[model samples]
Each structure stands twice: as C-alpha cells, then as structure tokens.
Target: SDQRTAWLPAFLAYYNARRPHSALGYQPPASRIPGNNLLQLNS
Candidate 1:
C-alpha cells in the first residue's frame, strides 16, 4: 500500500533506534548497534 510505503521508513527508524529485539539478546536497537553508524546518523 502507498500509505504503508510512506510510513515504512519512519517505522524502521524507530525500530532500529529504540525497539528491543529478542534475536539480539533482548537488547534495544541501540544496544545491539555495532559502532558509530547510529552516532553518525544523529550528526
């Protein structure tokens, strides 16, 4: 759906920023982050 497509990035941003994942050992996306990639995003 077009509406869902538009909202996808936003959803991913939050998912990769704040959402915790059981696959990553019950850690928030931030904790599971590997390095400075996320840091670079904010800059």
Candidate 2:
C-alpha cells in the first residue's frame, strides 16, 4: 500500500540506522539494501 511505500525512505533510514536484521547479521539497511544484497527487499 501507499502508506508503506510512502514511508519507505523513512523505514530505510531506520532499517539502516536502527533496525537490526537477522539475515543481515543484525546490520541495518545502509549495508543491506543496495548492491548484490537484494534479499532485503521492500516496496
């Protein structure tokens, strides 16, 4: 939905700076969003 998409950047910021991803070994989006690591996908 638009609600989730609209805040993508916001979530990305958090995902990169605050959220700890298990697949990312507790890393954030900054290191898990772009490049070859496409598993951490979003809409």
Q: What TM-score do all the candidates reach, one by one?
A: 0.51, 0.38
Say what the RMSD of model 1 is: 4.9
Which model scores highest in lDDT? 1
Model 2, 1-43: lDDT tens digits are 9999999998777867788888878887566457775665863
Judged by lDDT against the true structure, how good is candidate 2? 0.76
The models' CA-based lDDT, in order, is: 0.79, 0.76
Candidate 1 local lDDT, 1-43, one digit each (tens): 9999999999998888778789988677777555757576566
Residue-pair clash count for candidate 2: 2
TM-score of 2: 0.38
